[model samples]
Target: MTATAPDQDIALAGILRAQHGVISWRQARRRLTGSAVNHRVVSGRWQRVHLGVYLAYPGQVTRIQRWWIASLAVGNGRPALLAGLTALRLHGLRLPEAAEPVHLLLPAHRTDRDPPPGVVVHRTRRLSRADARLDMSPPCTTAARSMVDAAQWAFDDTTAVSIVAATFQQRLVVLDQVRTVLGTSRRLRRRPVIESAVADAGGGSESAYEIEFLRLCRLAGLPRPSRQSVRRDRSGRRRYRDVYFDPWRVQVEIDGSQHMETRGWYADMRSGNEIAISGVRLLRFPGWAVRHRPGEVIADVRAALEAAGWHGPSLSAGSGSATASHDGRVPHRTRPILPG
Candidate 1:
């Protein structure tokens, strides 16, 4: 039996609500006459976002609305779930470059070319039901699958690793989930690099800076330091150190850009004072210094470790014993520092 007009109105409203006010021409044609759809667009009540996708509102499209438009525009009678960095953002994994050019995943059989501008479509044979969260509005890949996709599609190795690390740090997904996804995605790009990053993240390297610091230690031949080690401050509050040489009583803090903020700066100063009062030698380096000035970071860390009773091999700057590669990578070192 044909549905009544009120029922069609209710269905259309529900779709617009769930899709963030975006709809496809194919969907609109089912609920209303072609003249009705065209009248809304002509009267400025709706805007065409793509060839067949329309926004119910006339104002600027939000980021999330853009996601909906991307999915609906390219769906083309098939699944088109958001994946890669775009899905990672929806999973609450914040990053500097997590905006624009919505990434989408389509079935391997999809041969449709010419996706709308500012949309990237990736075809995969392994987009199983387990990999996608169909229940979500503007459906996206699962967090673990999204992380894998984001890492696989990242512009560079560092970015790939950073995405994985941030996912773990944000508690968006578990190590086992990521490993399970990787286990099934056998032919993924940068698989080894993603695995190494996952290992580091699982070992408690909560940020990319900490991961880089661990690499520097291995490059300089320094004894591995525990990462994100927990200890009580003077007032008996639990404090986590970025890197700690437990035996030598030396601690190194890697300050990210957030440390420049007033509150973060004060909090860090307090943490430093606590470390000093606890009789641990404290050394601090900004995130940039770790990436751009690894040699200096290595020299200072080596000196502090030596002074605190580490008799490791000298990695002095003058002797040229240990140095980072020109590309700012530590060669032949992929071991992760376990937490204490």
Candidate 2:
């Protein structure tokens, strides 16, 4: 049942339009001769972007087009899904840095010895249909799997934490989805790191600000505060505190741009007044302060904790201390809280 020339032309046009003006040599050959493909490239109507991928139109390529080209080139005749940081970016997660060498996941039975430039091929035996959806135009992993994979492939622990935090903050993926993907993944590298980061994100520190604040508290030697602690105002209305040092009666609030709203601002003011009347000292830090001026914020928090009668060991300026690392990494320690 071969289609007529008019039908083939219509199908090819549809594919070109849907794939952002990109097509593979093998696909083009299905509708066109080898000479026709070469003639289009030679005439500047198509540009060879990868070994077997060509742009149908000679115009600026978009990020998605680049991803599509990479996938098609590596795919060859097997399954190759965009993954890791690349997939996360596709799902709209703001990464600290752009992911170079686009990550592509291929099945174990398949291999790409000559991946196109700026593409990194990852071989996995467990790339099941459940883990990826081919219906997507660019064809990538599920949001959950992409987030977890990005976290595992992060450059450092901090970056990994940030990736998970951003994914949750953006609401691109849910915690349960991440957990399910991890449970199903067979060879997930750095499983514990990914789990810890995702746990922290789900445990109320979902934003970059909250994650940075958590790290700051750890590095500053402050007692771990209850995250998103529940409380009731005088009218019996429920409210949640970002971080609460129960023993010291200190409340730390991380304010993002959303708090700039008139209603939100008023609510915060009311909450602060109530908290102050209840003898709870509130320390508020803008998201920028938490991320950019952490040292100053930590110092202020330390002073507030001390003023609130916290008499635990103070942060010392030496090796293994918060000040020494300066990277916001707190050394693990076990110290019982003593009576002030």
Best by TM-score: 1
lDDT of 1 by residue, 1-340 (tens): 9989999999999989988899988899999999999999999999998888899998899988888888877787333799988988887777776346889999988765557888888888888989989988779999999998989899998888788888999999987888789779779897767877887787889898888787778668899889898998767888898999999999999998999999999989988888898799999999989878887788798889888878986546755345666765455544443322
lDDT of 2 by residue, 1-340 (tens): 9889999899899888878788888888899889988999999988998788899886888888888888888988233699988887877777656447799988888868568778888777777778896877688998898888777787876677778888887888877788789778777776755676676677667576786677667656778888888899999988888888999999999998889999999988988999999999999989877766777788788889999998756455553447523664344343322111
Worst 10 residues of 1 by lDDT: 331-340
Tell me the alpha-carbon RMSD of every candidate: 3.4, 6.0
TM-score against truth, every candidate: 0.88, 0.75
lDDT of 2 at 272: 92
Looking at candidate 2, the ten consecutive residues that score lowest on lDDT are: 331-340
As for model 2, its CA RMSD to the true structure in angstroms is 6.0
Please list all clashing residue pairs in model 2, or write none if there are none.
Answer: none
Clashes of 1: 0
lDDT of 2 at 80: 64
